[model samples]
Target: MKQKSTSPWAWVPTLYFAEGIPYVVVMTVSVIMYKRLGISNADIALYTSWLYLPWVIKFAWSPLVDILKTKRWWIVVMQLLIGAGLGGVALTIPVPDFFQYTLLFFWLLAFSSATHDIAADGFYMLDLDEHKQAYFIGIRSTFYRLAMITGQGLLIILAGFIESSTGLEPVEFSVTTQSTHTEWVVPQAKSVTTGGENQFVVTQADVVIGLNKLNKIQADSIKDWAHKQNLSNGFVIKEVQLEQAPGWWSSNVATPLKESLKERFGKEDKSAMFKGEVQGNIAAFGIRLAQMPEEGENVVLNLDRQSGAKDLSLVEGHRLTFNNQNWDQQAWVLVQADPKLDTAVSADFRGLSGNIPFAWSVTFFVLAILFVVFLIYHRFFLPRPAADKPVAESKNMLNEFVETFVSFFKKENFAIGLLFILVFRLGESQLVKLASPFLLDAREAGGLGLTTGDVGLIYGTIGIIFLTLGGIIGGYLASRNGLKYWIWWMTLAINLPNLTYVYLSYATPESMWIVACSVAVEQFGYGFGFTAYMLYLIYFSEGKSKTAHYAICSGLMALGMMIPGMISGWLQEIVGYQNFFIWVMICTIPGFLIIKFLKIDPTFGIKKQ
Candidate 1:
C-alpha cells in the first residue's frame, strides 16, 4: 500500500492539544468542580486522587498498544471512547448520585486518556524522522500548553460565567461597623410567610454590627457553639433549623464514620482559636425563598464580597443550596468584623442563585463535543505511515516487556534513582490538590474565599504564564550551565517558594493581585525546579531499553503524586489550611534529603560546544 504523507503541521498540534485536555480535566478541573458542588474536601481529594491510578499503572498496558493494533487505530478509537466518557460525565452531573457516576466516567476518561497518550507518543516517533522529530518537539509542547490554558483557564472561566449569569438577579447588601456598643442580644424570631416562586427574600436589606469584642469566655462559648453547628464563630442571634433531616446515609453512615475519624485523628487546638487579644465581632442574617423550587431544580446562593472594607468580611454562608424541600427554611449568613476595627466601615456583598450542577454539566458537554471533533479530525487527517504498524512477533512481546523491566532494575544506583524520582515532589504532590480548594473555601475556614472565576483568572492564566516563563528560563540556564551545577538551586527554587502558600493561608488577603502574585511565585518555582526533575529522568533512563524505562519512571512520578494527594485533603480538614501549608513546607525536607544521594553527570543538559 502507498503510504499517505500529510503535513506534520496538520496533525501534531491538534494531536497534542487533544492529549493535554483530558489530563487537565481529569486531574485539575475535577477538584474545582467537586469543591463548588459542596463535596467535603476529604472526599474531593481522596476520590479525585484515585483518578491518577490509570496513569500510574499505564505502563502495564502500554505494551498492548504496540502488540495489537496500529498506533493510528489506537489513537482514533481512544478519542471516541474519551468523547463517550465525557458525555457520560455530563449526563450524570445533575443526578442525585452525580459524584459516584461522574467518578465512574472519570475513570473511563482517565484510562482512555492514558492509552491515548501511549499511542499518540508512539505514533509521533513512527510518523516523523529523527530530524523532524527534534524540530517539532517545541511545537508539540507549545500546543500541549495551549491545551492546558484552554482546559484550566478558558473552560473554568466559562463555567464561572455561567454560574454568575444563570441565576436570579443578584441581591446586593452592605454591612457597616459602628463604634457604639450594642448589647449582644438574640433577635426575636419573626413569623414565617411564603412568597411567590423563585423569589429570594432577605430578612434585612442591610445590617449594622457593633465593633465591641466579646469577652474571652463569651467568645469561646460562641466559637464552641458555632463549631458544633458547623457554622463560623459569630453571634447566632436567631437559630434556623432545617425543616427535614438529611438522608439516612448522611445521618446514619457518613456522619458516624466522620465523627469516629475526627475523634481519632482530628485534635483541635483551642488556643489557636483566640490568637489575638480581642475576638472579632460577628452577626448573622437570614435568607429564604418565597416559595419552593420546582421538582429536580436546586437554587444555589453564592455570596461574595463585591466592594467593601477588607476588615468587614463574610465569614460564613458563602454558599447555600435550596430545593423544594428546604426553600422556606432560613439560611444564615455570618459576617465578622476585624478585631482591630474601631471606626465605621462598610462592606458590600452580593448573592446569586445559580444552578451549580447545570454550569458544570454544560462545561463537560462542551468537552464531549470537543473530543468528538478531535476524533473526526484525526481520523481523516492523521497520516498513514508504513512504520506505524503493529509488532509482528506478538508472542515475544511479553518477554521483551519483562526484560525492559529487568534492565531498568539492574541499572547503576537503581534504588537511589527510584527514591529520587518518588520523593522529588513530595510537597508539591499535596499542594496541587488543596490549592484550589483553599482558594474556594470560606473565610472562616482560613481560605482566600475566592470565587471560581477569580481562581481561574489568578491560578490558571496568570500563574500558568509565570510557570511557563520559569520553565523556559530554567531550560536556558540548564543548557548553559548543565544540570549538576543548577540542581541544588533548582531544588531550592521549587521548595522555598512554597512559603507563599503559608503566607497566603495566614493572611488570606482579599486583594486579587496579592493572591495572583503569590500563586505566580509558587508556580514559577515549581516550573523552574521541575526542569531538573525531567532532566534527571532522561539521564536515569539512558542505555538499553531507555524508552521503556522512561515510561516506568513517569508512572512512578504519578504514583508519588497520587498517594500524597489522596491524604492532603484529610490532613487539611484536620489541621486547617493555615497549618496544612506549614506541613507542606516540612514535607519538602525529604525531597531535599533524597537529592544528596543522587549521582549525576556534570555535563548533562549542557549544549555540547
Candidate 2:
C-alpha cells in the first residue's frame, strides 16, 4: 500500500473541490444571482430557495448508481451532465423568457451536482490508502472550502460587476424642462416658457368641486380650532401635473388675492374682508391616503381600505374646504382659493407599466460561465483520466462500491457507525438549507425578510468558515478522545442552541445587529457541537473502502437535509415563520432520540489513543 510520493493522495483535494462547486452554485449562488436581477426579494426567497430539492432527495437514487455503475463512472458522467446544464444556461441567456427557462436549467444542474457528490465520495475511498486519508483530511476540507469560495465569492462578484456594468435602471421620464407652468394653470394664459404653443402642463384649477358649504360638525370644529389659535383665514395652494410629463412640476395654486381685492372690493372694503374670517358657511371635502405597503421603494399606495398594510400616519378627518361660492377657482382673491396637492409622486399612477423589470446582463454572464465550464470539461478533462492510469486491480461495479462496507462492517460496529455519521452533522443537513430561506421570508409570514446579499455574506462566508473549523475540530476530538462521549454532548449542543432561532422568531429584534449576533451565536454553537460527530464518521470509515462508505454517508446526509428543507418551505409557508421555528424546536424530540440511542465512548473526543 506504500505510495510513491508525498503527493500520491492529491485526489482528495480535487474531490472536495468538485464537491463544493456544484453545491454552492446550485444551492447558494443561484439565490444571490436571482436577487440582483430585480426579482422581488420575497419571490426570490420563495422560489429560488426551493432549489435545495436536489440535495435533500438525492439519496433515493444513490443506491441505484451503487447497484449499476462504478463510482468513478458516476463522477465523470455527472460532471458532463452538469456541464451540459450550465451550457444550456449560457445559451439561453439572451433568449426570450430566459428567467423562467433558466430556473429549470439550474434544477437540472442541481441533480447532476448531487449525483456527482455521491461518486466523488465513493472514488475517494477506492483511491486512497489509510495514511493518505489521514494526511488528506485537511486537504478535503480545504479544497471544499475553496469550492464554496469560488462559487459564492468569485462567480457572484463577477455577476455583481456584470450587473453594475451593463444593467439599466432606466432613464424612465428623461426630463424635458422647456414646458411652461402658467399656461398649464390658466389654460389660455401665455406659457411659462413664454412662447411655446404646446399646452404641456395639466391644471386642476378649472375643475370646481361644486360643494362650497361646510358641514356643521367641521364648521364648528374649524371655527373653534381657528379661534383657539387666534388664526385668520389663509389658504394653502398647490397645482400638479403629476404624471405624463417630463421634468414636469406643478407649483402650488397661486391666487393673486391682493391685486384681485383691489379689483373686487375697491381698496377700502378689502382690508376688513382680508382681516376678517368667513362667518357665513364652510364646506369640507377630503381624500383619504389609505394604502399601506408592506415593502419596497417608491411604493404607490394601493389605497384600498381593506387591503394593504394599515396606514399608521393617518389622522382623523384630514380635509379641504371652500369658504364661499363667490370664490374664484381660476383667480386669486380674498373670496377665492386654489387647488393644492402635497404629495408629488409622479410615476404614472393610472396603470401597471411603471414597475417594469430592469433588463440586465447577469443572466448572460451566468450563461457564459456555464459554457466555459462545459468546454473545459469536454475538451480537456473528461478524456484525460483513462489514458493516465490503468485499472490494474478491477472489480465488479457493486463490488467496488461495497468494498469499504464489507471490510469495516465486520470489525467496526455498523449501528455505532451510522450513529456517529448521523450525530456528527446532527441537524446541519436540516439547518444549512433551511435557515437562509426562513430568514428571508416576510415578517407576516414568519421569516426575517433579509435581503439575498446579506444572507450570502452572513451564512455563506461566516457559516462556511465555522463549519470547516468545526469539521477540523471534530476530527481532532475523535483522534484525541473516543468519539462516543464527545458526540452525545456535541449533538446536544448542536440541536439545543438551534432553539435560539425559535425564540428569535417571536422576540422581534428590531435591529439588524440583534439578528446578526443571534445568528452568529447559533452558528458558532453549531460549529462547536458538530466537531465530534464528523470525526466519528471518519473513525467508522477507517479501513479499506472508508472513502466510498464515507461518500455514501455524505449522500445520506444530503438526503437528511433535503427532506427537511423540502417540507421546511411549506411548513414555514403554512405555520408562518415564528411557528415554523417553534416547530423546528419541537423536532428536537427526534434529535434527542438519535443521541440517546447511540452510545459512544465518553473519552471519544478527548484524544486519539
> Which number leads on lDDT?
1
Go through the candidates in order and give the C-alpha RMSD of each one to the true structure: 8.7, 20.4
lDDT (tens digit, per residue) of candidate 2 on 423-460:
34434555556687766554544556565445656676
Which regions of candidate 2 fall more than 4 Å away from where they truly are? Answer: 1-3, 6-14, 27-81, 95-108, 126-153, 163-468, 479-485, 499-518, 535-552, 562-609
Error of 2 at 178 (Å): 32
Cα deviation of 523, candidate 2, in Å: 1.2
lDDT of 1 by residue, 361-440 (tens): 99999999999999999999999988777653556877766766777789999999999898889999999999998887
TM-score of each: 0.65, 0.49
Candidate 2 shows a clash count of 30
Worst 10 residues of 2 by lDDT: 344-353
